[model samples]
Target: MTRSAASVPTFPGSTILGQFARSLISLAKAFKDRREVRNLAEFDERMLKDIGLTRSDVTSALAEPIHHHPSWVLVRCVGRPAEAHKMTAAHKPRPVVPLASRV
Candidate 1:
């Protein structure tokens, strides 16, 4: 007895339902991140600054499109200073120790 193609079982992981579920999960994550970013706005400037962010950074991040992750903007804003510091530190010359001093 041969089974018809329509009678075959399809794995849920490889079906449209799986893709739709994954998309829904991603959307939920984005919404959660957005809410967290919004909460950051309530923090004082000093608190924000302690985390390497500013009021303007929070405002700019919040201004991004709803679908986009606002936390990424904040990450970029916070990273800029650290990256700049790294670049500047890289350019500084290190002092050389005299080989003859090691007796």
Candidate 2:
């Protein structure tokens, strides 16, 4: 009989520590997201509209649970020229090097 690496049982102590680490990471992410949403609240109505958001939308997002991602609303908004350029840059494929030259 063959056993794959995935079949190995995890140590109970390590499992507990891993879960604790994940919780800490999640808490940190929630804090950062809440801060970003608060910053967005400072934008005036016209600026919000330009970003395809209403003042009400910002309010609603702020009211959501901290674990909820409010940035999704901003992501769905119309992209400014600068933002569009950033998106294009992010998606641009990396140049591939020949295997022989990699060494």
Candidate 3:
């Protein structure tokens, strides 16, 4: 390291770059949390107005595929309904012994 560069005061701790990166990550997470909080359409109308979003946006986002998920689930969404139908048919209960117990 240069002798002159070493003389600079470093806030008695970590660097501004490190601080900036940490702040950016923290901001990102905060936005993510806000998005999740907004997802719950259970919020009242006044609350929605305060957040500056409508119920439709939340409902529409719910329809969209989640960011991270199993690849097979994504395939299922893209593929023909025939596969889903067969899977459903195979799992369906017969009249004899149903998997669902009466509550």
Candidate 4:
């Protein structure tokens, strides 16, 4: 009796569950980024200039989708490092190999 690759079940955290968790994390990060952008928009002109930005810059960044990430936009404008925000790709699990398919 042999099982094909398609017959193998993906255990939790191997594929489906891992993808779900990554998506949830991404959503949370996006929300946080959006809030940060909104707060930046509230800053005075002097504060904005200190960060190498203007009112228009904040407006332009806030216009983008939350997932697009405004902090990167600010980093480019300032040409200096600030508080780092990490972004990484989701984990992709390898295809399951059934017992019979093993070399």
Candidate 5:
């Protein structure tokens, strides 16, 4: 009786699957090299909007930057509360605009 040889998957001879694997590896490397954000204060409100977060999120983050795993700290930051002057209860007047003639 004759037995057939078994073939193992590998990168060789410009195969379609090999190309796809290479593409995936390249994408992974690119993502791994991406910049990391370690703090919320560095980002402005507009930048936060791009990533779907608000000001309150930043405030909370600064308050307590702790996380379950130490690795998580590489990209997260807990911001501290604003100074007393900023959070104090004070009223400011808004400018009134005159309406144009609409008779």
Candidate 6:
């Protein structure tokens, strides 16, 4: 016997209420991350550079919409250069030493 669509059970997260709750949680997390980003603003340029970030990065992140997570912007900014550097380094040809050269 085939089960009817009406008889099928829906997962909790697939319900409207569940989606609303998830949205609330995500909003809360964004606000929390924004606060942390604000704290990063207090760091001097040198300090910010130490962590692969700059003052402009913090400013741009803070400029993002309230509901959006600002730290995500900072992460993208910081990660891009590193990722590019890794990609370039990975593709570069390395000198191959002959095994016989090592006595």
Most accurate candidate by TM-score? 6
Winning model by lDDT: 6
TM-score of 6: 0.67
Clashing pairs in 6: none
lDDT of each: 0.90, 0.77, 0.57, 0.75, 0.50, 0.94
TM-score of each: 0.66, 0.57, 0.29, 0.59, 0.27, 0.67
Candidate 3 lDDT score relative to the true structure: 0.57
| Model 4 spans > 4 angstroms off | 1-13, 80-103
Per residue, candidate 6 scores C-alpha lDDT tens digits across 4-45 of 998988876578888899999999999999999999999999
Better by lDDT, candidate 5 or 4: 4
RMSD of each: 7.0, 16.9, 14.0, 24.6, 13.8, 8.1
Can you tell me which runs of candidate 1 are displaced by over 4 Å? 1-8, 11-14, 86-103
Across residues 1-54, which tens digit of lDDT does each residue of candidate 4 receive?
A: 988998978776688788989888987887788799899989999999887788
Candidate number with the higher lDDT (2 or 5): 2
Model 2, which residues run further than 4 Å from truth?
Answer: 1-10, 73-103
lDDT of 5 by residue, 1-103 (tens): 6655555455466588888898788656444433223354578899876665566665553444332222233234322223333555354456799989988
Model 3: lDDT of residue 91: 100
lDDT of 3 by residue, 59-93 (tens): 55455544422223323433435577799999999
In Å, residue 90's CA in model 1 sits off its true spot by 7.4
What range of 10 consecutive residues in model 2 has the weakest lDDT sum? 72-81
In lDDT terms, how accurate is model 2?
0.77
